[model samples]
Target chain A: MLEITDIVTSYGKIEALKGVSLSVAPGKITCLLGPNGAGKTTTMMTVAGLLKPRRGNIAFEERNITGRDPGHIVQSGIALVPENRLVFPDMTVHDNLRTGAYSRSDDEIEDDIARMFERFPRLHERQEQHAGTLSGGEQQMLAVARALMARPKLLLMDEPSLGLAPLIVEEIFRIIRDLNAEGTSIFLVEQNVHQALKVAHYFYLLEQGRVTFGGSPGDLEEDEVIQRAYLGSAEQT
Target chain B: MEFVDYLQAVTDGVMQGAYYALIGIGFTLIFGVMNKINLAYAAAAFGGAYASLGVAALIGTGDDFGLPPLIMFLVSAIAAGLFAWIVYTICFRFTPDHYELATLMATVGAFFLIEEIAVHSTAGEPMDFPEVLQGIVDDPMIEFSDAFAIRGDLLTIFLLALIAMGLLLMLLYRTKLGLATRAVAQQRTAAQLCGISVDRTNATTFIIAGVLGGLAGAMIGAAVGVLSPLLFVPLTVKGLIVTVIGGLGSIPGAIVAGLLVGGLENVFLALRGITERDMYVMLLLFLFLAFRPQGLFGKKAVRD
Candidate 1:
């Protein structure tokens, strides 16, 4: 449902993405694994239209959305849960979700918000509380729930498990899997390779702004070099 | 020497406070949304008064295309708002957002530009504004000590300001637009990620401030019976002083500080003299900056 062709993005003199390219099919959880400063977040931002690329194109469901404004891109069916879970700290949980559907003119915004609350009961409990007051896990949940309020065709999450406890990380992964199972295509960027490989239908390894490996998780699991680079100190099993 | 005199002074203090609150609220609102102070606000307020005077003159005369006094005031407000938007777009918006010094200098330039325009338009002469609340309540009998009294216009300005403040409070606390504005103010990048248009939000914020400033300007003109460019520069300084003493971005701080400044200034004028009155006010501002730089309601700065 999403296609990126050799997009190059940069900041001042430093180029973050040097002609990186990738794709995600419909209703699948595609994971991009990368180390620190591997331009993973840059790639996600470019796709979300936050940063304009200097070269190549980005297409969503056969429509070219390369240079559209971020607001227009989001309205056209792509929602990004930005890195670091940058929820509007001063706004209440409900307001943050309402802000997510800012472009929608539909009458069921309150219903959608209620549905999100039902999906995450923790969010309902803290609906009136300031988002910044939430715990890290709850804030991550709020960020993901906020993205879902946009009702996008694809959800792009950047390092949703960063700085979370192991149990909370597992819960986040489970939510990702459940959302994918419900036919919402997800492009997740993570450094947690073992857990990502277990859930990702297909995985790509990005290093130095290049996609070095792309295949099914089983194929990557079988490769010794890929396994060592990804697993690091942990056992590949 | 009498209870009536004390009551009259208090009544006058409240009226002056209303004017200060109106101007201070504009200053605070602009600073809250943009994080940049518009030093040109006082000048804009004076500019609105001039517009009101000109429009009212045209209406009172046999001009076929003139608007009524109320409609003229609203049009004057819109004109002032448009003028403010133009000034912001031209002066501040193009400059780097982080170079706050540059933004400050731009607003200073705008201040002088507005002052010069007012002077040139009126040929440095003060023009009288038509009484907005004439005959409605110009002479209300007061039962206070049989001597001291208050004008109907003073009461009207004070009551109207309170009403305006109530409306503003409702807008900020209850409206969706205000919620979006607050989000943008808190975090621009996060607000943009939520698909809130930053430019539109900022523009709306400026227009709102401009309208408030305009109303304050008209009331001041009515109270003083004349509008002049000379008043622009002093009002600008006083507004800035109020904003700083109240707190940078705190709405309630602005209201409380505005009244405090207004009451103190009048009390000093009553006891001492007008010449040394501003010295005490300036000293208070210095103390606020030197000690509690956060003023009343400002948040503690988070170190980066």
Candidate 2:
């Protein structure tokens, strides 16, 4: 479980996250929904320890992890699949997977890599090819598989579906659900409201660096603002 | 008849190019990881050379050059690595990652600082450097033909440079630290997310480049048989040119460009004499900058 309290993160004079608070329950897929510039990616980055928060604290499993280095955060069992699938372009897909496990010294890393290849068979087929040469969908899959290489207790993914095809989006949602069912908690940031609603048990709506609403997906269906802003009509909402 | 002369020039140029490649690779390694140019690199390298020469003086080999070439090289390389560590701490470590210009300017400052120290100490006088094969044999030149031959010292330095490059390639491609380094170089934030320490990797990178730079300095000093403050600026300029022509972040590119530049420099020297030789080299750099700025093997995106 992860709990964030009044975290304020900034870029020079401008603040991206202003007193934002949220919680991700254990063994569940919790989704964060927000418009562009709503500080969604900023929050994920902050929790991943890439950006040090200006205020407040983040606790994972009741231990304060605020302002820790990203390496320490990963060692504490949290891994992030950053937005835009930042796979190493010049490195081969296999090398990309190898880097994902950089923090661990366990001997089972090869076994875990094998597991990743099995789950994402296309990655296995293209193991020696440069990641930059992969398609958008394949790259996204590689990103998720790479993150899974860390064997984290919690997986933080920022917009894994952005720019993906509809079928690929469906596949991504399926992977998220599958990952959660397999006992890896997921904290996902998504722009695809419908697909996210179908899979996310709990969701938070962030607006302008603040959390506006938090509830079950059923409760989300009744919110007029969210329906209008994210979903086109009440029926689809 | 002219072909034999050009061939001889190329052979000598390759021997010289080995040192150039070492220097260029030093620049390329640091640039690949940090994406920030450390102008102090060459100064640190030559600083290592001067330190070894100082050691030679202390050991009473100041006049006769009785010290073995191997020990001199090792001492110079280690000292250079230390100098680089100082540069990294002062210029890069505390500087905020986003403020790249700060690091660049700081390195430029470090460069002048080291060069000034060397100048003040040596009083702008050139010191003699030990030759690798001077005392080993009576005839120090290996001849393939009447027109083609390599000095025993140059040949030894060339072989040593090749060995160093081979070891470097092995370290990069075969080791876990190298994997971390390459990962960090490719995607800093992503590497961080994967729990790679960017600071540690950067520091390690600086030291590695420093050692390699030191080796390059020793090799150049050995080849030219002198340690002069005047050689620092020109060699540093050549190193940068090698980095650009090889491709900013490409090691293989650096190696090829170094040899190409070295060979071409010699060919030009054979045809046009010394003053115009550098002019042609500068012209080659200008052509590269104009037409293939990404360099022979660098990805175009590196220009971004």
Displacement of residue A42 (Cα, Å) in model 1 is 1.3
True contacts kept of each: 0.56, 0.89
Model 1 over residues A1-237: C-alpha lDDT tens digits? Answer: 899999999997788999988999999999988666778999999988889999989999999999788888889889999898888787799888988888788989999999999989999999999998999999999999988988998999999999999999999999999999898999999877778888899888787777877888888543542454454324212
Summarize candidate 2's per-residue lDDT along B1-304 as a digit string, tens digits.
3898999888899889988898899899999999989888999999999998888888864267656877899989999999999999999999987898999999889999999999999999998898888677889988888877878888888889899999999998888899889988988888899999988899999898888888989898898989988988888999999999999978999899989999999999999999899899999999999999998888886511
For each candidate in turn, the TM-score is: 0.92, 0.96
Give stretches of model 1 more than 4 Å off: A222-237, B1-10, B62-72, B138-143, B146-150, B302-304
Local distance difference test values of all predictions, in order: 0.81, 0.89
Question: How does model 1 fare in lDDT?
Answer: 0.81
Positional deviation of B102 in candidate 2, in angstroms? 2.4
DockQ of 2: 0.85
